[model samples]
Target chain A: MIKQLILIGLLGILFGVFFVSMQDIQELYNTFGKDYIAATGFADTGSRNLVTAILLDYRLFDSLFEAGILLIAVSGVIWISKHESQEKNAQFMLDKFKTPDLFVTFSRLVYPLMLAFGFYVIINGHVSPGGGFQGGAIIATAILILYYIDADKDTNIALIVTIEKILYIAILLVASLSLVSRGELFTNFFVIDASPDTKAIYLVLLNVMIGMKVALGLWTIFTAFLKEGR
Target chain B: MNPLLTFVVILIGFYGLSTSSNIIKSVFCVTIIESGVILLFLNLGNLDGGVIPIIGDALPVGGIADPLPQALMITTIVIGSTVTALALMLCIKVFHHYGTVEWAEILSRESGK
Candidate 1:
């Protein structure tokens, strides 16, 4: 009886706290106002979107390092999986898991559309709501769906790895170019006077690379898990 | 609503963090809590009588809505998805190793192993 009472009391308090917190959301708007836009407008980067300015300029280093982190994680997963004992023979495992006909047909039908949409999001990230990370993740989602549905399909691990490598190299090149343009070695470059066309090109390129890398990385990781399961 | 509601979400998230025994459930709770913060941010950027930030005839000349929040939201959304995927992968690994998804049981088993 005492325990039940205490639980009830806790629940009541939790709900009360939740209710109170929800009431305070309005204050945040009052404080920030249009300052967010104003700040972005003053930034050295040429991107019109403040968020883009912040991401590609003010916080470019963080973004670069974040990509590095993903690289490390991918490398770690590959290293770990490579050493694990190969359960049942590869051929046997492959044979046991047949790709469903419906899944194969659907994937074939949808893959091109998914890829096109993903590219569109990546390219238009600068002017619109979407960006490289979001677009990349969407692409990754499509690849993941394909992987999940086609269990018996033989994946070209080497090809995936190659694509990931190329993308990483391309990103590094873009980052390097940005740094060079700013005359800062190993530093973030926010070129304020650059033409909109240049910014769009760089942003779109970055998105496409990120999309490719993320999709491949995820596919590789899933493949490792499937191997582990077998 | 108001900042108070954001706080409420945080509090609820904390409660879930403290009480939930399932790892996946706890991850979800944390996500919910993060979402509360995101909501606070979005609310912060909103202005009275503002139009959508998009260019052209849809928006009035003077009333441009805040664009920063939308961009931030996009970043947050991507980060959230990545975190969720990573957490799910971690959960799967935990399940594979311990044959259970409950936090306490997994910990006990790990200790034994």
Candidate 2:
């Protein structure tokens, strides 16, 4: 323990040294970059949110690989934890059983609002702070509420996994559409000289696909944990 | 100063990882480390008088926060959660195998076998 403590102290010293020598961070490496994004990001991606524009357009290929990583991770998790005892056919349904008065009332009031907000965030991602990942997480939280309302609520993990895989493929295909129109991937053809409405649709479509994919992926992981050793 | 604090958070995680005997505690330590790293990245990217990354009619891009770090951090957050889930799942399997969550106990048992 003493030796480990010393190692931690050394780590802290290293971090301190790095921070002390850190350069001024306000001026980015490219002085022109932030201004460029702010000026043209909307025209380029039709998304009011510059971060989303950067994510789904500027560094889109990276985003694709990022989603792929999640896909692989989810698959690995399910494979590692799978058991023969699991039902061959599982389904996802809301809680049919009743809980305490308070829990049920809470679910009834909050669940719809949560679900609607998830959609709102996703659809308005181009225009707001929320986007695919955040909105999808919110939707996943809403789904989790069902378990609290009724412990016996039937959830279909396999179905969710399948849906996630399909969505990923769709995302890849949709992203590749730009490859045909332009010589690059993930850059929308409609972006070059398209109307604002078309650009908005493109961003919304991508957001919805990503939102669904993430929500399903997260739900699968949650279900896997719940079914562990069961 | 805030950067130093974030670094301290990382050190705290390191301290926990080095001292914690249990497997689950180690997983939590890694999570703490991830959080600290995320915080540090955001701190570095935080501008003095910058607004949020969202562009509006009134809020222009001239004084907006750096979008690069925020975007990268979103990816980092999702990756971290998946990693934590996988780690916990592994911990569960390890416990099932050795009948204990303690690192030393598991190590000792392995050698005994």
lDDT per residue as tens, model 1, B47-95: 3556555443232456555665665565566556555656766777778
Interface RMSD of each: 4.4, 1.5
The true-versus-predicted C-alpha distance at residue B3 of model 1, in Å, is: 4.1
lDDT of 1: 0.64
On the 0 to 100 scale, the lDDT of residue A129 in model 1 is 57
- Give fnat of each prediction, in order: 0.18, 0.59
CA deviation > 4 Å runs, candidate 2: A23-30, A87-99, B57-62
Cα lDDT tens digits, model 1, A1-230, are: 67556765886787777667556645644525454444444334445555555566555566666666666566655655564554543232544667678877888788778877887877776666566776777777677666555555566666777777778877777777755677764323446576656555666666567666766776766665565555
Considering only chain B, report the TM-score of model 2.
0.90
Q: What local lDDT does model 2 show for residue B86? A: 89
